[model samples]
Target: MSMIEFKLNGKPVAFDGNPLKRLLDVIRDDFGITGTKEGCGEGECGACSVLKDGKLVTSCIIPVGAVGGCEIITIEGLRDTPQGKCLVESFAEGGAVQCGFCIPGMVMAAEALLMNNPHPTEADIRLAISGNICRCTGYDLIVESILLASKKGEGLW
Candidate 1:
């Protein structure tokens, strides 16, 4: 066991356990943050997506040790932010919240994209969320939602 320190949701935190433990497990079990869900533990699915140092990554594929000194932002951390609110409100207003299993990952992916490209094209939005899989919604609404957020949430991202 090792003590790994990192910034989680804008706060500095530490974990003392198996270094090889997945960040998803640490976030959900150790830190009790259940917003980030595990879909395909193999990392093929983006349901466990989180922001690692402001980049979108699958928490399930990342080891706890790898995140030391990095900033990790999960859905719980984002849902309250202005940008997050914009994305979420866009998702809701655009009817992209079907089934809602992959919304968190989708939102995270959108945030990661918007932070870098406040004015992204459809192709950009598609590519940004390509890692995520949403069985419901067909991605049209999600794409439109992101586009809407980009336009409506100007100066926020």
Candidate 2:
């Protein structure tokens, strides 16, 4: 076991555990942050997506040791921010969410995209969420929701 330290959400966290442990497990099992789900452990599905140093990554395939000194943001963390709230509201308003399993990852992806480009085009929205697979709601509503959020741009930086 090794001591791993990193910033989670907005707080500094340190813990001693197997350095090779999957980040998804550490976030959910150890930290009790279940917002990051495990859909495909191989990183194909974006359900376990999170922001590592402001970049979207699959937590399932990333070892805890690799994230030391990096800033990680899970869906729970995103929900607390204004941009996250806007995405949530826009997703709901545009009926982009269904079954709810994929929304968290989708939201994180959208958040990352908007943070980088607040006024993304339709193609950009599609490209941004391309990694996230939503079996419930089709891509149309999701894209529309992102467009709506882009128009709002209240919380996005």
Candidate 3:
């Protein structure tokens, strides 16, 4: 086991695990941050999305060793941010969630997108969240909520 040091949710954290262990497992199992889901173990799906140094990343495929010295942001980290709450509220109001499995990752992806481009067009929103698949919602409402949030200026970083 190797000791890894990083910042999670804006706080310092350390964990002992295999160097190649997935960051998603470390966050969910070791740190009790279950918001980062394990959908496809590969990087194809954004189910394990997290922000590494303010950029959207798939935690499931990232090794713990690669995360050291970086700041990490999970869905839970957004509770204290206006952007996070706004998007969540909009998602609910827009009926963007169903089954709820993909909500966390989708939200994180949306946050990253909105932070970079608060006024993203529909195509931008679609491309940004394309990695995340929601088997339940068919993505119509999801896109709608993001577009709505963008127009409202909720995604400003």
Candidate 4:
């Protein structure tokens, strides 16, 4: 077992558990952050994505020890941010959200993309969300949402 300390949302927290325990399990079971979904145990799916020090990563594949002293931002934390609100609105307005299982990870990935490339092309948007798969929208609406969001200034987010 190992002791891991990190910022969850904006608050500091610590846990003692197996070093290899998935961050998803620690968040969902120990920390009670259910917004970060577990679609796949492996890292291929983005359903378990979260921001680790402001970069998108599959929480399921991240061992608890790996997150020691890191700041972890889950979907629950995103909902409280201005960027998150903008993305959520754009997602709903553009019909990008469906079934809702993949929306959080999609939104997180989109936010990361927008942060890096404020004016991304359609192909860039596609590539940004490539790690995330949606069984519901076929990606057209999702792409549209990212494009629409890019026009907004980073300060707005």
Candidate 5:
């Protein structure tokens, strides 16, 4: 066992456990950040997505040790930020959320995209969130939501 150190939601944290432990489990069970859900154990589903050093990744398949010295941002951490507020509000206003199970991951994907590319085209938005699968609104609403957020939440990204 080793003490894996990383920044979580802008805060430094250490996890002393098996290095192979899933980051998703650590975030949810150890760190108590349940906003990052687990739709599938595999990485195909984006429900367990989080921002690792500004890149979107599937936490469920990521080893906690892999994030050592990196910054991991979960939905809970982003919820209070301006970017998060913008995306959430945009998703809501654009009817992006339905069952809400995948909304958190979708928002994380959007955040990652917006932070990297503030003015993303529809194709860019679609590519950014390609890993995420939403059974609720298909994907038009979500795409529209991201586009709207890019316009409405300008300068925040």
Candidate 6:
């Protein structure tokens, strides 16, 4: 076992476990942050998405040892920010959520895209969330919700 330290949702966190344990497991089992779901347990599904140092990553494929000294942001972390709130409200207003299995990762992907490109086009929105898959909402509402959130400008940052 190794002691890995990192920042989670703006707070410092430490985990003592196998260095190679999947980050998804560490976040969910060790840290008790259940918002980062495990879908495929592989990189194919975006259900395990998280932000490591402001970059979107699939926690399921990432090793806990690789995240030391990094800033990891899970869905719970996003809920604590204005941008997160905007995304959630936009998703609800646009009716982009259903079943909710994919919403958390979708939200994080949207947040990363908006933070980098405040004025993204429809194509940009689609491309940003391409890694995330939703079985509900037909993606139209999800696209619309991202567009709506993008329209909110800096307030989301």
Query: Which regions in candidate 5 have their CA more than 4 angstroms from the true location?
Result: none
Give the higher-lDDT candidate: 3 or 5: 5
Model 3 residue pairs with clashes: none
In order, how many clashes per candidate? 0, 0, 0, 0, 0, 0
Clashes of 3: 0
User: How much is 144 displaced in model 6, in angstroms?
Assistant: 0.3
Q: Which is the leading candidate under lDDT?
A: 1
TM-score of 3: 0.95
The candidate with the higher lDDT, 3 or 6, is: 6
Q: How many clashes in candidate 2?
A: 0
Question: What Cα-based lDDT does every candidate model obtain?
Answer: 0.95, 0.91, 0.89, 0.88, 0.94, 0.91
Best by TM-score: 1
Residue 113 error for model 3, in Å? 0.6
Off by over 4 Å in 3: none
All candidates' TM-scores? 0.98, 0.97, 0.95, 0.95, 0.97, 0.97
Q: Write the residue-wise lDDT of candidate 4 on 44-157 in tens digits.
A: 889999999989999989898898889999888987788888888888889887799999999999988887778889999999899998999879999998887776545664
Between prediction 1 and prediction 5, which has the larger lDDT? 1
lDDT at 145, model 5: 96
Residue 84 CA displacement from its true place in model 3, Å: 0.4
lDDT of 6 at 63: 98
Can you list the residue pairs that collide in candidate 2?
A: none
Please write out the lDDT profile of model 5 over residues 1-157, one tens digit for every residue: 9999999999999999999999999999998989999999899889999999999999999999999999999998998999999999999999999899999999999999999899999999999999999998889999999999999998998
Candidate 1 vs candidate 3: the lDDT winner is 1
Residues 45-74 of candidate 3 have per-residue lDDT tens digits of 888999999899999999999999999999
